[model samples]
Target: MKDLTSAVEHRQEHRFARSRDPRSAAKILVYHPEPEDYVVGIRRALPDAEVVFGSDPDFLRQHIGDTEIILAPRFPVEALQDAQRLKWIQSTNSGVDFLVPVRERLKNTLVTNARGVHGEVMADYVLGTVTMLHWDFPDLLRQQAAQQWKPKFVDPLSGKTIGIVGLGAIGAEIARRAKSAGMTVLGMRRGSARLGEPVDQYYTREEFDEFLSRSDFVVLVVPATTETYKLVGAKELSAMKRSGYLINISRGSVVDELALIRAIGDGQIAGAALDVFEVEPLPPTNPLWTMPNVIVTSHIAGNPTEYPRRILEIFFENARRYLAGEDLINVVNLARGY
Candidate 1:
């Protein structure tokens, strides 16, 4: 019988023998309670690569010895030091600030993120919240409680404009949905002057104030990076139209929670829908919980039951590219911090 393992070994033998550096098999460790199919699919995509399953942090510590790549939702900053063999890390989530310290220390390790997967779910969440606000659901709830049939005026989605702070996957999807609902859509990002499909206009960071001034609703979908931290704080908040509403489906730290409180308290903006906060499990005493004009959720905007399957698809695609020595997709640019 022919040796299948030797066939794979022969294909890599010349590359191994000629290189001054040792050519070891690529080994990946996945950290998260991910679907088994995710790991299995990636392994199938790169048959020669060694894939290990480690759902717990303790298992991660023990298995870091041979890990050349890590598929993680989040991991301890200390893991960067111990995982000396780690050459890359693929985060299942968009925000990576929690991994910044580790990223800084592991200068050579490449980092990729799942940027496109969560867009649809997040867009749907934003649209739902915005629609609820436009229809005055809160006011209607009060009237129901009081047993009153008071008629009130509500804003129409057709004539209004929505400004998206980031034109990435999530922002683009939001634009598409908002436009289909007859709202004018605008977006602002650090680069790219042109908007795709549904966006009527695109602005650079310098044009943020202009975008804010004209928007009746502003949606934030940017990731939490050095450049985006507190990007929508006091000054930005003050730039918007007083009757304008704000929606944050991005990370909490992207907006200054204190600044937002002051802005809303002073009636700087009409209302806000926040899905993420600076602190996880926001303390019961947090003022945001009591604010009448605010809608707060526990960071569930981008979550969907299909999340694991979507994440696995990206991993498998990248894993196949890795085997072919192709440049990986969605590779994070450390300097730009996306």
Candidate 2:
């Protein structure tokens, strides 16, 4: 276990120490590659917990049955299913789709996420991609390759409608930047009506298509769930302004890849900047890879900066709350998937 990053330094270690209750501290298993990189800080955070850190799947499988709390980015579902005394799980990723495999077994356990951490970096990346989509950088690059100098007028970010789906932490940051750039920000989510939100207008789940039709640019940031699987399909694409562009920073399953390909081919939508796909490493034969109008990035929207220091932040706070008998933050609802 080697600390690959300086993320869990001394200061963060002391922040949690004051809040932890020695008597209430439970055994914590930090399962990650080179688990020691974070173990020192985690141990300092909850001084009384029996902190066993490991990178081996077999070691995790061997110890998981007696562990009360698990902080891991990856865990064998079979081992996860056998946890006897597990009370809480701190998932390192904002999206907990991986846990779907063990959702039924952990009905009694609490699940939380590292969501807000990616907000700033992800928003910056999404907005940059959105700008590329709007400016038709692909076309410009093609012209550059052809050595053709054709200047075309394009609308500025200001006054253009930018609709955000799944207005969570990432979406909110996007809205803030869009607003700063003078763009009209529209947002959709379960309870987007909350006052003081960054969005200029809010749409509910029922008005999904209506929401889709109005935006000049649509950004998908929703979680991948049964309700959101292929949330953007043929009809949904048809709803958008044909000139509009899509920027997906969400899971690939959230959008229908085949429908998106067909839509792009037929010009149902202008183009897309895709960071995720239905199948990762996006099969070489996939049309999106070669499409001049699309930008495909291997799922890296959340990590413009690595070292999940933010996830550890969430874990630290939650660990304190768990020991203090306080309500945890980022508690996930498995059924809704956010």
Candidate 3:
């Protein structure tokens, strides 16, 4: 496979390998909860490869030993223990942070993710939430439910500042949409060096508090990693404007759940729209469910109706490149946990 490299500041030089052709000795494991949905496409993509599809753990253990490639949104990390012929693993999900813990086990395998596909849908979701907050739609719905006709004025989004916590692919999409709305886009990432993106201002790692204080609506689009786990807590929350709103499309662990509840309860910040949570299905006893200012959505922000179509596209294209002994796209840098 091709070796592509050019330093992009904080980003890593992605490495790919010349893989064994499926027609030869390569064996592939196509794993999914519903394997029937993908079998045809997977087979069509790798016509000469030996492919096995299943979701059962026993089935996985039975076939994973000599598999050269495994494709799925998720699978048991433990199943990779004896995957000696595993040359690569294609993840249907964009974030590969979950594999950080078992980095040592995957030392020889190349990991690629569905990174480019989620940008449009996720950006649409984030922009939808932002407009809801800016126009006070939550309160308007409450009044409509109460049969009250109280009309109110709202500030326009044109002159507002939107701070993006992580400026990756999805974050770039969000920034583009926010900029189109005439809002000033402020972005913060670990890298201080600017690559000339669309953002109006770039905030360094040390300027987090000041960045938080200036935004009208803050969006969290970071991945889940040790450095980002509980990245937002009471102190971070307290730094924001009391009237500022928060939109988190990232993992729930990125924000401290307990601290978030207290911050909203105490009116430290205005409110939040959360798509991911620490506990899924968010227990009936959790206070976030009843908070009039909060919006709790199940983790459905990324994998919408067209998810399978886009993710499979990435998988097939990369499969062609891998089989042709060319560069594979979206190869992840495990050390950085993207």
TM per candidate comes to 0.85, 0.86, 0.91
Model 2 regions lying over 4 Å from their true place = 1-26, 33-36, 44-48, 53-56, 145-148, 304-306
Model 1: per-residue Cα lDDT over 1-338, one tens digit each: 11111122112112111111244466678787863866777666666667788677788888886677788888776756676566667889887767765556656666788988888888899889888878767767878999999867766789889999888778888888999999999888766555346878878788889999999999998878878889898999999999888999888888999999999999999889999999989889999998888888998998878777788788777655555555677877666667
Tens digit per residue, CA lDDT, model 2, 157-265:
8969999998877888888998989998999987636666778888887898888899988999898888898999998999999988889999999998999999999
> Total clashes, candidate 3?
0
Candidate 1's displacement at residue 41, Å, is: 5.6
Backbone clash count, each prediction separately: 0, 3, 0
Candidates' lDDT values, in order? 0.78, 0.80, 0.82
Model 3: residue 207 alpha-carbon error in angstroms: 0.7
Stretches of candidate 3 above 4 Å error? 1-25, 192-196
| Whole-model lDDT, model 1 | 0.78
Better of 1 and 3 by TM-score: 3
Model 1, position 286, has a per-residue lDDT of 91
Scored against the true structure, residue 257 in model 3 reaches a CA lDDT of 92
